[model samples]
Target chain A: MPGSFVPAVVSRRRYQILGIIALAALVGAELLGLSASPPDRDMGHLQKIMYVHVPAAWSAFLAFFVVFIGSVLYLWKREERYDLLAAAAAEVALVLTALTLALGSIWGRPTWGVWWTWDPRLTTTAILLVMTVGYLALRSFVDEPDRRARWSAAVGILASLNVLVVYKSVQWWRTLHQVQSSPSTVDPAYALGLRLNALAFLLVLVYFILLRYRAARLERLVEAQAEARELAQGEELHV
Target chain B: MTPGSRRRLVLAGGAIVVLCGFGFLLYGGIGENLVYFLTPSELLARGERAYDTPVRLGGQVLPGSVRWDAEALDLRFRLTDGTQTLVVRSTGAPPQMFREGIGVVVEGRYREGGVFESTNLMVKHSNEYRPPAPGERPQDLYRTLLGEERS
Candidate 1:
């Protein structure tokens, strides 16, 4: 609480820098992936969709991991800031996860000839997306801040475990979805583009999480101020 | 640790344990049969049990085994897993990227005859992506690889 206000003031002045950097990185990465990478020998140009979809998945996982960490820390330390941080990451994670699913669906319809499937990898990931929406819904339904934070932290920890299950679904079960693609798995020609886009998406995740966290903190501060003013008025009336 | 933190820790641990148990049951109850699809040999091993009911069969398309009639929408191919092979027949057009040696999962039933009748065909692509060499653009190669010509 002591150092919180100082950083809040500083962040207010400089947060736009993060947004600009994220935008520039994203544009450059898209260009590199779309132009520099060659067409696949098999799927040809359709393979280019991986540049966006894979990175979206990666950023979503990263955001969810942050939510897990924030939840655990909040439960252990009983801090209000950690709960706000987790909620912000959860929101960003939801967006990125939805983006990943949409991109995958668009790519799938062309290649797999279906918009959706009950494959293990796809199903588990869908469950994660649904759980995230439920987690956010749970937060909104609760009124008391401490109770909301406590219960949501508990739920976040539970749902975060699904991330590991979803990541391993392809390997653990024979799925329509392919296994993880990395430098060793993917061709050398396309690896650089994937890495660049992944870096760009990571920046995007950070920007969104920080921006949301700042807004949440400001909202809480205003609410606290209003409550303080009401208490002062009550005391003056009693006097 | 304070009593409150200790209580929180216990609550978190209990929730995790309960969740894991639920996950295990879900996996054991349904995941045992969810291989997505069975290979030629796996389905064959099932013998009479694999008949009538819907089944998903997956394997590599054996080279030179594809037959397609665009007008009739009849497609037939032999799927193999190196150890065994089986015939797959469907009434719909196969996917664009369906080529010899590409992996596919076809869903239907092993009818009275030998063929595995597929109601739905899904392509399972490999993770690798290699660009065609200078002379062989995908557009040039695309026309010949659409399951009509044996490559």
Candidate 2:
């Protein structure tokens, strides 16, 4: 049975190449963002923080979207692979959400004169971070694979619905946090740096998710092998 | 249709209904619970109901209406939306950027005397960047710390 499974060596090599590419992109992105981008007319040097803050936010949202797709597929097809993908995406989304919040706060202190506020956009984002953390925790407390997959999939789907609310919160309510900044709203001079960082973050996200999914599959295979050995021992004792 | 396919269709339909119901409830709850920021005119338009409930009053600080007592930590100002003005009373050292004509959002409740008692005062500025005025650089504000480190 173990031999029937796909060899790990090939996948490990693929992950290594991906990891190196991701690291290179991240380093290049930082150099370009820190040096190449001119200072903003309003925010000055502080605007440089946008390179990290915005990309982290975009990646976090992208991760949640993956979770949404994974959850839906898991429910429809009852596939363990879908559950693994959803779990992987949720963990990544949680980390990126935390980074987004931290960077935004750091940016806020100098600009908004406060470290944090209860503005709609900021508040909803914090809620999203907490909810995703809860979803990951739910996955941990359940030991049975099928039960865990079913429960967490439902939660992943529901929690991702909050992403829409977080995105729309600024428009739905009057918030101190500024509305989403896009290329149209941002100065043309800043666009290149932002796009570069966004691409770098995206590459890093893809690498992390693939690595996590592969790890999950390996763990599942090990568990199956252990269960099979236990069953064989029981049969020998009965004989 | 096969029984399995029919069952799946029913399950999907049920999930959609449940999700829609949850969405509606969430929307209604947020609408009622959210204390939206309003200008003085909009708050007044709500009449007596606006009194004592938590509200975020946002507008420019009326020039010449600011009164601050540093020792007492009492700050008073009038916020205006051009058409109407409301007095705000707060207790704190105003933020370093607080100034007349700048936008501010005060979180608190309006009292019977027409004063908005703000528990928090947040200074807001336009997004357009401008070079710091002479002597107002962030580095200058931390000169004492930098001097200590240098020594």
Candidate 3:
């Protein structure tokens, strides 16, 4: 009775509303990025790519951080919900990371004069992308729920730690990639657009993670129901 | 101690051990693989040890020292770090952004012939947003027919 108190569909509706709001804000952020931000003196219009690139990268980092926390919690508590949450966050993080890399490549062609390079930051980020893909692939291979949860959680934790290396790669080694930009380093005229876009991306990240988590939970629920029905039918045949 | 507390202690101990192992590996990997960008003076400071090993040489392209053979895809330039200079030779067309007095990073091994043999060249832009100074524009290098009419 308590489990049936609140229906799942109601929660999904809330996520839908949030998703709409996020989409609208993202559009607004794009408009601001195009019109409000001043062009870089050297790079000129090519610098506008940063509005999407930096925010997507930041959101990817944030999503992976969530995966790190979820994995740690699942490992400690042995909770299925934490595992589900971790899987959902990992999925979102992978998508955002791929987007970040694509946008980066497009920006690099005009700015760095190369479509891709083996610079330290680029190399480390590429490694991160590969590791995350491996993490998701590993999750799919394990059929047993508990085993999948434990193994994927461990991998997720390890992959999350690699994110730190990616962040510090520019500083630790010689790289063609520019150093991290901050409010102090970035021109104030461009800062407002960047910050606005970053906020819009954060909203989108939260909405996506929430929807993905709910879908994962629904999938597990259906699986459990199917297993219960199979067991009941076997008992009926015996009777 | 209660079994729950004991289990927690074991879990925490395992986590610490795994994290420490990972940290050690990461540290060693970074230490071994970190390629430093050095000026010619810094590279020469290492003496004979710097020869034959790959390095990223970072400095400004010295003015009036660039030679480009577009047909042969040959590029030769002198890179200077204010105090010292090194001659660099490469087998590719220079990047569109490459210009005299601009910063560049050339990646390659130093050969015995006193020339830095570069396999890859990257233009390095400054973090600050500054317009090109007067007479520093690449457009000025061209003898425009439009400019002749004005003259």
Q: Give the winner by TM-score.
A: 1
> Model 3, residue A97: what's the lDDT?
94
DockQ of each: 0.39, 0.17, 0.18
Please give, for residues A25-100, the per-residue lDDT of candidate 2 as tens digits: 9899889888976655445577788889989999999999999999999999997889999998998899899999
Looking at model 1 chain A, report the run of 10 residues with the lowest lDDT sum: A1-10
TM-scores, in order shown?
Answer: 0.88, 0.78, 0.80
* TM-scores, chain B, all models: 0.75, 0.67, 0.68
The better candidate by DockQ, 2 or 3, is 3
Model 3 TM-score relative to the real fold: 0.80
lDDT of 3: 0.79
> What ranges in model 1 sit over 4 Å off?
A1-7, A11-13, B1-30, B133-135, B139-142, B145-151
lDDT of 1 by residue, A128-185 (tens): 8877876787676565689879988987987788899889989888899998876776
Candidate 1 — what's its lDDT?
0.83
Error of 2 at B71 (Å): 9.1
TM-score of chain B of 3: 0.68
In model 1, residue pairs whose N, Cα or C atoms come closer than 3 Å (at least 3 residues apart or on different chains), thus clashing, are none
Q: lDDT per model, in order?
A: 0.83, 0.79, 0.79
